[model samples]
Target chain A: MKGNSYLSRKLHSLLGVIPLSLFIITHALTNFSAVEGGSERFKAAVGFINGLPLVNVLELFGIFIPLIFHGVYGLYIAYQSNLNTGQFSYGRNWAFALQRISGVITFIFVFWHVYQTRFQVAIGGITHDQLGMTMHNIATNPLFFTLYVIGVLASTFHFANGMWAFLVSWGITVSPRAQRVSSYIWMVVFVLVSAMFLMSLSAFRGDEFKEAAAALDAIRTIV
Target chain B: MAETTVAKKSIKFVITRQDKPDSQPYKETFEIPYRPNMNVISALMEIQRNPVKDDGNKTSPVCWDSNCLEEVCGACSMVINGKPRQACTALIDKLEQPIRLEPMRTFPVVRDLVINRDRMFNALKRVKAWIPIDGTYDLGPGPRMKETKRQWAYELSKCMTCGVCLESCPNVNERNTFIGPAAISQVRLFNAHPTGEMNMEERLETLMSDGGIEGCGNSQNCVRACPKGIPLTTSIAAINKDTTKHMFKQWLGM
Candidate 1:
């Protein structure tokens, strides 16, 4: 029973980095295309992903299943942590507490973001081409925009800090100096990834995305 | 006149006190005449002798455990000025005013500053943190270790089981069974020994269980808070690698 938990804990750490972290990186890149080449490029990126053979299979195994396991097990781990940052106010101590806090935040944000987009599509509420329009609607709403910003920041921080823990637990960064260097690298990652997500959000609020969505709607009406 | 004025100056101490194992803890302030080069132990002794509160009321002597006044003996571990360390080494001159002394709550507190360290000892037992040898037969000379290896291993041997590493860890509290960092590092120390390596697989197996190596959250606080300057996080990482291999070996039925 104990050995089972050991494997499960390691698997939790591994899954966070392997498919989940990779998915976050790719998802950010796909979103960032909106900022770089307007809604057309964003649509193309989304279309390219949706058009892939075995896309549903990939989503199930690569994204949804891993996400559920990581998110649920992460909540358990968070519950087990005894946060004592008040007494031990060291930087790493704060980071430990924040890791758990951000894990919960990211779990909520990811689920809500998915429900707003993918689940909406499943129910035939919107077409894949209207993803940019859906994002635009979200980004322009004051409450949802604020929530997205907080969610994006929280998710990025969780990933970056989690990567640092992953390196240590997996025996990659063994020495203090290596751990110190790894922290700096991960902080940079946090900033860069956060910038990518924020820029994409801002792009959704742009007039070009509205025009693109309107054009897509017009073509649908004509058809 | 200057000597008289210096004699009047006093040091203030705020100690968290509990009358019994199950009693609620409370704070008591004491003022003792200033002395140069005085450590926390000496101040505590002053309070014990006089047994007077800052309010000028008589009280029972504060109880604490100590053997060697030096930092070598791990018995005098406590939280001083919000850091878990040896009270013997916490210099009054270096500490902030109103030096706060509290029992290390990571273990169950027996009295004022005395805590039961059985949890740490039990963790050591769980990991079998010792080299086995039969006493009946004359075991011949042990295999020699390389000088370089001995040097690093000596650093690990300095651990007095003071429980400071455990006290500083956020994961080693009442809510969880995590064995904390001290025992994990001990496993690393003993496993490296020539004779001790005989039971290396057994130790690694223990580390793969509940309240074992996987319990570490990699907060890195234990390494920072260790008074003996042991490379604890390094040991944990080494153990993690070893456990990974062990887990695979078991999975492959090897």
Candidate 2:
């Protein structure tokens, strides 16, 4: 019997590289645009994305499908595997365990985020500065601010570490030195991306989007 | 209180049994007269000789696989007292009873304690975990490796294909086609050899394929489960690095 289940493994890796990672990196960078470019750049970017033809189909096929697959498949893998970090406690072992843990957190964060924001805009008929106002309101709340920070960290860590794993498993970075180089690069990515996400969140904490958020709050109160 | 003069000197066992590969497995209890310094294998032998259950009914001998009566063969590997290891080396004195013996469920159980370890062997085959030899004639005194390299390679060569590592591994399940740690480690061993480097690309390519190295979730269970203390995770890391380099070479047509 051919014992090797190659398709699932390849698909998981492929999905991580393509739509999943691609979407995540783009999403993070776009959100980071709020750091200096203000709400106009952020809203413009969101508008551009929302203005695309077949935006619903593009999201369902290009983003949601891949994200759900990668997230769910990753969970199944984590479930089947035994954690030995408690016994072995090596750096690589810890990294392995942390990857799954971060994956779970990121999955939850991403889902909750989309539910609170995306669905509200798409299905709930809430729009016009939806991204800016919603995020600003969320950050103003202490509990949600903490969650947003954690979500940012978790997603960034997942992407950065996942990139290293992707390179190694795909036979890209084969030498110890190369693997180390990739590790260093990914670590840099984690820090920079995390800082960018935090800075964007911090921008929301300011009064720049206060009017938009207060308008939404008044609408919510009246409804 | 009434005092008893005869000390109860028996070992209790709760063994998982299946009459055939497709049979429904059930637990069968056995109590055997204890002997000092006896291991699980010896206790099993006593039960085999008696062919009787703890309830005084005659039954077939409790079946398991073992050879060399030592930890080397890997045939004797099973889940003893909840840990996967060679039963021959699991000293009864050290284990808590009633000892539980179960077949390594990672592979198909043949009958009772005998599991088809073909998965592991096939994985080794998949990676071509060997140095290719042209003929039976003397290829007299092949290339000598450095002493330090030979020492580590010898350690990697100690794997007996026992399937314990696979049993402990979370990634090696029915749901996935991971080749497991043993084969990956073996790839490292062969790739380190002077002659083996000729087939290095082939081996690396095999690992780069679907059920290959990418399947590793890095649980770190295999290293702890290896009876020979082989640096399995280390080998995996090394091979992971090597395969990427090999892919680069292949892409560059070097």
Candidate 3:
């Protein structure tokens, strides 16, 4: 097993899609709910997730643990890659290089994002209901807003491009035509997912969210 | 006047040369009288005969490996004008002027334009990329393949082990032991055969090891780089599936 990195590599690919990708989709949709149905809707979505039976266990095994392995191992893989896209300039070659680049960006962004939101909740610095207010504050800052935009783009690209690699490596798309089709499909996924995320970001800065954040702050002051 | 000028036309070559395997490489330029439909190999031959630089200095003849004088042999694979292909088929008419010839640096340079292809041969051996027929006694009329399967498999069989696929692959360089694309495609070719199917599991096991099928980053440069147009990525994807199934079978203790 010393020289055999096969199982580990496959596990990395598997963990990327199984819980990680699934988690990302749910997360984007949940955030989009803030814009679609406003703060109350976003609260209900978070509440429903947090209220699930054995929610802590689910988060630990389903999201956090898998995420740690995927991110840490992904960093190792990114480091191992010797990108020659400058010389090659092939479409897949650029995808290969961009995949690793986006992985690194997404990893850092995800770490900071989880720390700013989820970790803050865990540490009692902000309650679950105050998540909207917290996001509002972050989104209003021009620098943070720009960072969030870049982060969302990188994360979506990583997920979508990763999905393409996963399909091919798992033997789902075995032919060149199948691979070409798969790439086009994933490109669409990247665009749609990125749009969803960016929409949520803009929603945070909306008047409705600002009013809701103000109401939350007023109640907190009164209490 | 135009006929004489056309007859006196010449091609310029800028070739990288190394005196020894461990020595640094240097560039030498040569101008050769061009002929119609002459390929890179022919120009190199003219240089070999003259052994003179464009600067009118006497020099050593350029060295390269080639056989079959056709694309069939994997030999004579060198980087011509920044692309990896066989010099035998790289017609001078098609290439840009002052054509740069260099060794396919993926493999160690033995001399000018000659690379030691032991890595590819080792990869083939590692995968046991052949049917294990007993040659001591005659084994006649082995299992036959379906015409449809044989049609595609025949396309895969055109691999000359030219090392171009390896040269084009980012993962098959000095930092990693990636067995590269050619041998992986060869595995698909052999494993599809009736007699060859016997050792399919063994071959898959090797692919499951380090520097095996797992090394493919899916950059997909191999398929495009292959002069024969072998479906390298398709074979890689197929082998990826096989190895996954094989891993499960091993886990199940079957």
Best candidate according to lDDT: 3
lDDT of 2 by residue, B1-254 (tens): 89779886999999999999998999989999988999999998999899788899988898899998888899989988778899999999999999999999888999889999997888889999888887879777668789999999999999999998888776788776688999999999998998897789899889888778877875667887899999887788788668656766876999
lDDT of 3 by residue, A1-116 (tens): 25478888899999999999999999999998987898889889889889999999999999999999999988878776788787689999999999999999999999999999
In model 3 chain B, the worst 10-residue window by lDDT is B1-10
lDDT of 3 at A125: 94
| TM-score for each of the candidates | 0.96, 0.75, 0.95
The candidate that wins on TM-score is 1
DockQ of model 2 vs. true complex: 0.33
- lDDT of the structure predicted as candidate 2: 0.84
Candidate 1 vs. true structure, TM-score: 0.96
Q: Which ten residues in a row have the lowest lDDT in candidate 2 chain B?
A: B239-248
Candidate 3 Cα misplacement greater than 4 A, ranges: A1-3, B1-7, B135-140
Report the lDDT tens digits of candidate 1 across residue range A104-218.
9999999999999999999999889899999999999999999999999999999999999999888778778898999999999999999999999999999887887888889
Q: Model 2, which residues run further than 4 Å from truth? A: A1-112, A115-130, A136-212, A215-223, B1-6, B136-140
Using DockQ as the measure, what is the rank order of every candidate, best first?
1, 3, 2
- Candidate 3 chain A, run of 10 with poorest lDDT: A1-10
Give Cα distance to truth, residue B110, candidate 2, Å: 1.2
